[model samples]
Target: MMAKYGACLLCLSASVVGSAQAESLAISALGNLDLSYTQPQRVASYEGSPLPAQVEILPGNDYWISTPENIQQVHFLVGQGQRVSKGQAIVKLTGPEVFHYLAQVEAAASLYQLAKSRYERNKPLLANGSISAEKWREISQDYFTTHLEYEHMQHFMERVHSTDAATDSLVVAAPVDGIVKLNAISGPYMAGDQLFSMVPNNSIRVKVNVPTGQSHSLSAININQCHIAIESLSAIAEGAFVTAWSSAVPQECNLLLGQQMTVVPEYQKAVYLLPKNSVFSWEQDSQVFTLSDNQLNALTVDILGSTPEQYIVASDQDLSQLQVLSQSVAAVKGIMLGLGGE
Candidate 1:
C-alpha cells in the first residue's frame, strides 16, 4: 500500500512540474491538487500557550514567629488564618525560663541603681580632689557596665511581655500585621522553635521560569487570564531557565501561596499568524508557498510560537499582504520537494 501511494504521488508531482510552462495544463493540475490560498493575520504581539508558574510569598513579607525560650505550655491566642495587628498578643506561654529571666531583670536593676548612686556620689568628691581620679574612673566604668546589663535584661523581659515580672506566664505578640498560620504542636517546644508563620498584608507574588531560548522582549504575562504586573526578570540565567517575578497579586485572584498554575507569556513583536496546515518543513527550515502572478514561491519563516490550530511566524517578506497555500499543503509541498530533486 505504501509503495503504491509513493508511486502515485511521484506521478502527480511530475505532471504538475511538467505543466508549469503551459497555463492550461498548470491550471488543470492546480485544480486537481485542490490548492487554495489564505492571507496571514498580522498582530503587534502574541501570547503562547500556558506555561507552568508558581505563586509564592514575597521575600521579606514572610515571618516565622518563634519561641524565645523553652515553653512547657503553649496556647495560641489567635486562630489559624486570623488577621492580627502588630504587637497584638498572639501566644500565651508558660515555662521556668520566663520566671528565671524575670528574676535576672530585677537583680540587674538593683545592681544598676547601686552603681549609679556610687558614680554620682564620687563625682563631687573627685571634683573637690577628695577622691582619686583612678577611683572615680573605676566608679564610672561600673556605672556604664551595670546600666547596659540592666537595659539588656529589661529588653529581654519586654520581648516576652513580662516586663513587670508580675505573672508566671508570658505572652508573645505579633511582630507585624498579617494572616496567622500555626506551626506549633500541642507538646512543649524548645527555644527558637517556630510556633507559627505570618504573611504580612497578603503580599504574595507569582514566579515564572522562562526558558533561555526565548530571546524576544517579554511584554506581558497573565495568570488564569488575569493580567499581572511583572515585578522583575533575573539577569542571570540558572542553568537553562531565567526566573521572573510578578508584583503583589490581588486577593480576588484567589491564588494561594506555593500554588502552581499555568501562565501565558506574551512577547512584544510584530508577527504573522497562519493556519497550522499552511506551513511545511523544507530543508530543516519552516517554509510556506506564496501565490504570486500564477507562480508558487517558497519563503522561509521564523516560528516564534503556536496554538492548537495556528502558528505565530515571522518572515523577511510581508506575509500579511500575500496569499499562502492553506489547503492540500502536503501534496503541494511534496511536489515542490520532488522538483527540487529531494
Candidate 2:
C-alpha cells in the first residue's frame, strides 16, 4: 500500500500522534511495507523433529498381479508398456504342472460323482429305516468331503489360465487396465517372482525415513498433517498416512528405490506460520513489528521451525495489534536505535 518512502523527522514524529490514516511505506531498490493490520496466522506445529525420508513408489491394491507358480513356455500377448484393459488377455502359458494339476482334478471329480450317487441311492433306504442312521451319516460325510475337494480343484484350474485359449495352453489376463511390463511375459518364470509392475501412473507417496532413535514422533502425525518435499525435483506434496507397507518399487521416477528424502511432519500445537521476511532479530530476541495508534511496537517470537521461506514461531501474546510489514525489515533495529537517541 506504500505510495513512496515519504520522509519524516524521527525525533519530532517518533513519539507523536496524528489522524493521518495508516499508509504503506514504499522504498526504491527495496519493497513496499503495508501498514494494514495483519494478525499472525495460527497453526498446529509438530514438536516431533524432522528426519530424512524417501519417496517410494507404492503399488496400489487396485490390481497388483503376480505369477502364482512356475510357468513353462510363457508368451506375452501384449507388448511392453502397452495399456491393457481389465480382464484382457495378457499372456499365453503352458507347463507340465498344469496337466498334472488337471489329472488330480479329474480324479477328485470321479470320486465326488461316485460318492454323490451312493448318497442319493441310500437316501430312501435311510428314510424307510432300511439303513442305520450311523451308515447314512457316514455316506453323507464322504459325499460332502469329496464334493468340496472337487470344487477346490475346479477353482484352482479356473485360474490356471484364461478360458479362451485356442490351444491347450493356459491364458492369463490383466486384472485391471494398466500398461504391460514388456519383459514380464517373454520367458518362463518361477512362482512368487514379479510378473509385471504398474502404477496408477500418478498415485504415489513419499515415505520418510526416521532413524530408530527418532521414530518415536511418528505416532503424533496423521495423513493430512504430513508434507514431503522432493529435494532433487524441487517438488512438494502432502502425505497420506500409511499403516501397512510393501516392498514393490516404482516403475518410473527420477528417483532410486533407496533415495533419502526430507519430510516435514506436523503435530497439533499452538504456533504461527509466517513469512520469513516478516520476522526480524535483535540481539537474542526474534521479533516482528506491530503497528498500533500509528506507532510500531516489537513483539518477541520464539521460532520453532523454519523452511526455506517460512518460519514456525511459538508466541504467547495476543495478535490483535500485529501488522504485516511489506518492506525489508532488516533495518528495523536501526530505526529503533534512532528513536532511542531522540
Candidate 3:
C-alpha cells in the first residue's frame, strides 16, 4: 500500500512539473512585455527644441552695378558702402576706341561742310543756265551726301559727350536711393557684372529652415499672416508675404540677404508631433509600441505630420489608456504570460 501511494505521489509531482514547463514555454514565446511610457497628448509636446539662428530682415529693392561697355578691367564707380542714386553715373571708362570714333566724326564733318558750299553755289548757276543741268544735278547730289555724313558725325559726338568721366567716373549709381551694402573692388569682372548691392534699413524677416515633411504644413498658412516675436528686441513684427520657397530642404532664408536669422513657423494644421526616434517601422508600416495590460502591443498609426525631431501619429487608440515606450525596451522572458496574467 505504501509503495502504491509513493508511486501516485511521484506521478502527481511529474505532472505538475510538466505543466509548469509548458506554461513557461508559452510565456517565453510572447517575447518582451510592454512597459508604461509617458506619451504626450498633444503633438506639439513632442517637438524638439527650436534650432538656433540669428535675427535677419528682408532686403528692399537692390541692384548690382556693372560696366556699360561689358569689357573687363574697368574701375569701380564707388567704394564699398557708398550711397548712390538713379541714373547717377557710377563708373567711367576711357579707351583707345573711344578716341578713334571721335577723330572719325571730326574728319567727316569738315568734308561735309565743303560739299554744302559747292551745292549752294551750283543751285543759282543751274537756274541762270550758267552751268548745264547735269553739272548742277551732280553738285546737288554731293550736298545731300555731305549733309548725311555731317549729321552722322554729330550723333557720334553726342554719344561720346554723354559718357561721364569725372564725378560719374567708372562708378555705378544706385537704382534707388538706399544704403550701399556691398562693393566688390579689385577683381577682374566683365561688363554687366555686379559690382555693388544696396538695401534699405530695418527690413527684418524671420527666416526658418523647414523640413520637407513639414512643407505642406506651411502652405496652409498665409505670408504675413501672423506676428513674430523677436527675442532680442522684445518686439513683435507683422508677417508679410515675401517669396515662395525654393529648395526641398531650405537650409537658408533671405530675411536679410547674406545674413542668418531665427524664425518660428506656426502651422495651421493640428499635428501630432513626436520624437523621430520614438517612432519605428515594422512590416513596412509605421508603428509605436504601447503598453496595454502591462504588455507591449504594436500600434499602427498614420503619420499626420512630422519634423526632424518629432513625429505626428494619427490613430484611433484611446490615448489616455495607451502608453508608449520612451526608451528601447529590453527582451523579457515569459512576456506572454505576464500579458495574459490578468
Candidate 4:
C-alpha cells in the first residue's frame, strides 16, 4: 500500500464528497487497492426472502356438516383433502335415533296413504248430500295433517339414505362439490355436533403474515418458482404483522388445500441492483463512488431494499452511464479520511 499521501491527504480530505469534485485524482494514489468496478443492473422487479405461507379457506366458503340426531357410531367414507361431488356419500351412521326416525317416517307414509284413500272415497258422498258436512270436514282435516307429516319426513330422508335397512345404517351425502377439510374420527357425536367440514375448490387462498415494517403492497407471490398473483391484503393488522392474501390457485399450480409452503413477494418498479461493497455511508447518506476521466466521484443513492450480497437502490440521476466501484471500498474510504498517511 502507498504510505505517502503527505499534505495532500489533509488538504483534500473532506467530511462529505459530492459528485462535483473537480480534482481528477489518479487511481494509483490509493495503493494496492485491487479496485474493481461493476455496472448496476436495471430491473423491473426483485424477489425477497421466502416467507411462510399457508393455504386456507375463506370464512364465507366454509361448509359445516352436522345432523340433528345423536351419532352413536360414525364411519367416514372419505378422508381429509379428498375431492367429492354432490350426492357422493361422505359418512355412514348407525344409531337408535337414526332407526327411530326411519320407522317414524314409514309410519307417517302409511297413515298419509290411508287418509288420502278415505278422503277420495267419501268426497262423492258429501257432494251428493249422502254424508253430513261435518263428517266430510273431519276427513279433509285428517288428509291435510297426515300429508304435512309425510312431506316433512320425505325432506329428512333426502339428507340421509338407508344404506342397509336391516342394519339400521344410513349414509350422509355431500350437498355440494368440494374437498373434505375437517373429518371426524369414527366415534360418537352429540346431536348437532360438527361431523365434517368442506370448502369449494375456488374458495382456497394463500395466507402470509408479513412483518409490519416491510412492504405489504404486493400483487404477486412465488411458490416453487411459480408466480401467483395476489388478490388483496387484510386491512387490519394482527399485532406486529399484517396478513396478505392470494387468489385461488389454478389447477395447473398443483397446490393442495391446507398445504403449507414458502412464498416470495414480488412487485413491479424500476430499481438498480448493486453490489454490497460498492456502497458506503457519507454524512448518514448511502453513497457510491463513480469512476470517470480517471477520477472518483461520490454519488448519493436511495436504498429501497437489500439482500445479503446486493442492495436494491434508486437514484434520481441515471446510473446506467456511470460505473460504480465494486471492491476496495474500505481502503478508499480510509484514504479519503487522511488516515492512510499515518
Candidate 5:
C-alpha cells in the first residue's frame, strides 16, 4: 500500500490535476462515447480462468498396450519420454505364468495334431459306414477348434514369449509409434496392470472440468466453437469438443500424457458480455452507463467475471438493444457527483 495519494494529488491539483479532471468531466457531460453494437451472439463469451488439466494420449484405433498376465522381472525397452517406433520391442517379461500358459498351448497343439491325424484316418471309414458319422464330425470339430486356440497362443508369443526353449523372458513390441508414458507401479506388475503406456502419434486430448455452478455454460460448448490454450506450453491447442457432461467436457488437444498443465478452454455463455472499461465498480455495487431513450441511464449489473477479451455481465435490464459507453470511468464519477450527462 502506498503511504498516501493525497500528497501527490495536492502537489499537482493547481495545474495538471485541475486540467485533467476538467477534461474528464467535460467528456462525461458531453456524452461523446465510444459506442459499439452487440447481439446475443451465442451470448458473447471468452475463457480466462487457467484451470488444472493433464495431457492425455489418445490412441488411433487401439489406444493402450497392457500386460498379458502376471509376470515378474519385467524390463522395459523404452524409457519414459522416449519416442518409440512401430514394431519396436517395448517390454520383456519372465515368470512361471508365461511358461504355464505356454505349456497349456503346447499341450493343446499336440492334441490338435493327434485329432487331425485321426480325422484323416477316419474320414473314409465314416463315409463307408465303418464308423459313426457323428464320431467323425466330432473329431473334425475338435481338430479345428484346437488348431485355432493353438494358433492364437502362437501369436501371443510374438508379444510375450519365452526367450529360449525354457521360456525365460517374453518380449512385447510396440504396435504403433508413440512416446512412452508409464502408469503407477513399482516392480513386477501383475496381469491387467499397465506395464508401459505409449502416447501414440497425434493422439492427445484433454479433459476439462468446469465449476458445477457453470454447468449451463459447459453445455453450450462444441467442437467448432471451443478452443484451448495451454499456458505452460505457450501455445494454443485447437480442440474438437468430443464429449461433455453437465460440468465437464473432453476436448481433443495435442499434448503429452500425464503432463500437468494450465488450460483456458473457450466456451459459450448465457449472460451479457461487455467491455471491461464499460462497467465501473462502486462501494458494494457495479454499474454501467447505457444509452436508453437517448438518455444516459446508469444500469446496475451483476458481473459474473472477466475473461481475456470480455467482461461477463448479468443485467436485469435487456442490454442487447442498449449501447454502453466504453469510456464509462469518468461518466461514473460524474454520475456520482450529480453531474449526470444529458
Candidate 6:
C-alpha cells in the first residue's frame, strides 16, 4: 500500500510540472510585446561637415575716417551705435595750420593780380614804338616770367587753402546708410585714424562654415535653400547665397560678419522618420520588432540614416502587412505566442 501511494504521488508531481510549463507558455503569449512595421522610405543624411568655429555679422565694407591734420583738435559727430546716412558728417578737426594755408592762398592770389597788371601794361608799350625794341622785349619777357610765376603760386596757394579748410573743419561723412560700429571720442587723430565704422543696414548675408571633411556633404545639398536660425535675434532666415568657404574651418564666418547661428541645409532626398525607441540592437546589429498575425516577428533592419529624433531603416521585404509599435511594450513573450498562432 505504501508503494502504491508513492507511485500515485510521483504521477501527481509530474502532472503539476507539466501544467506549470503550459501556464508559463500561455502567460508569455498573453503578455504585451513591442511591435513595429516597415515601409519603403527614402532617407537622407549628411556626413560630418566642418562648420565655422564662430559666426559674425560685420559690415560688408567697413568705413574708417581720419582727420587730415598734423596737429589738430578732433570732434566726433555721431556716437557709437548711432545710425548715420550717406554723406552725413561724422567728425571735424581744426588747427592753426588751416588758417595758415588760407593766408598763403590769399597772398598768391594778390601776386597773380599784380603780375597780370604788369603784363597788360607792358604788352601795349611793346607793341607801340614808345619803348626801344630791346627794352620792350625785356619787359615783355619779364612780364611773361612773372605771370608764369604768379600762376604757379596761385595753384600752390589754392591747394594749400583747400587742404587747410579740410583740416580746419574735417567733415567725415558716412559712405552709406548704416549703424556706427565704433565710437571715436577724446582723440587727437592722425591722418589715418579710424574714428568710426559704419555697417550698412541692408547689406546682410547668411554665412555657414562647413568643416573641410564635411564640405563634400554640404556640396551634396543645396546651400541656397538651406535654413538658418539666428540665436541671439531669435530670427529665422533663408540662405541668400554662399559667398565663400575654405578647406579650413575659419574662426568666424566673416561674410555673416560675426553672428553666431545654427544652420540646417536642405537635403537632396526626403528622409524616412521613425521613432527613436523603435530600434533595437542584437549582436551589435540594428533591428526592429515587426508584428504580424497577432505575433511579434524579429527583423534585421539596415539603418539607412538617422537623426537625433528618429532613424531610417531599409528592408528587402514588404512591411505593409506588419504593424509597427511606436512605443515600448511591457513584455515581449506575447510576441512568441502570436508567432505560433500565425
Indicate the worst ten consecutive residues by lDDT in candidate 5: 1-10
Model 1 stretches with alpha carbons more than 4 Å out:
1-39, 59-61, 79-88, 95-167, 185-187, 236-238, 290-296, 315-335
lDDT of 4: 0.74
Model 6 error, position 302 (Å): 9.2
After superposing candidate 2 on the true structure, give the runs of residues whose Cα lies further than 4 Å from its correct spot: 1-71, 79-83, 95-107, 113-137, 160-167, 177-277, 282-285, 291-297, 302-321, 324-342
**What's the TM-score of each model vs. the native?**
0.66, 0.49, 0.34, 0.63, 0.54, 0.43
Q: Give lDDT for model 2.
A: 0.53
**Which of the numbered candidates is closest to the native, going by highest TM-score?**
1
Worst lDDT run of 10 residues, candidate 6, spans 1-10
Native-vs-model 1 lDDT?
0.71
Error in Å for residue 59 of model 4:
2.6
Task: Write one digit per residue (lDDT tens) for candidate 6, span 209-291.
Answer: 43322233343212223433322111333353233322222223233445454443322323344565766554445555665
Better of 2 and 6 by lDDT: 2
- Residues 1-342 of candidate 3: C-alpha lDDT, one tens digit per residue: 000011111110001111121112222344454433667455322221232343333434345443333334455456555544544554445554334444566687887888888887777877889999888878888888878977955642432314442333233345555446554567555545565555443333444544443433443111222334322221232242222222111223223344443333444343354455556554345656665554456556666445445555555665545566556433322343364521
Clash-forming residue pairs, model 1: none
Query: lDDT at 334 for candidate 2?
Result: 53
Full ranking by lDDT: 4, 1, 5, 2, 6, 3
Model 2 residue pairs with clashes: 33-326, 33-327, 46-267, 53-208, 53-209, 53-261, 80-182, 162-171
Compared to the true structure, candidate 6 yields what TM-score? 0.43
Clashes per candidate, residues 3 or more apart or on different chains: 0, 8, 22, 0, 2, 20
Query: lDDT score, residue 59, model 5?
Result: 29
Which segments of model 5 are wrong by more than 4 Å? 1-45, 56-74, 93-137, 158-170, 179-204, 213-256, 269-277, 280-286, 297-304, 307-321, 325-342
lDDT string, candidate 1, 238-317, tens digits? 89888888787777777766788878776666788788798877545677778877777767777766665677776677
* Candidate 2 per-residue C-alpha lDDT over 1-342 given as tens digits, one digit per residue, 9 for 90 to 100: 101111221111111122122222223312244333456676544444444555455544434455555767667788776656766777766777555555677799999999999999999999899999899989999999999999966754554445432344667667555455644545567766566655443334455543332233333322223433322221233342323222332344344434565443433456665677777665545667666555566666766565456566666765533665534465654555554511
Mark the 10 consecutive residues where model 3 has the least summed lDDT.
Answer: 1-10
Candidate numbers, best TM-score first, in rank order = 1, 4, 5, 2, 6, 3
Give the least accurate 10-residue stretch of model 4, judged by summed lDDT: 1-10
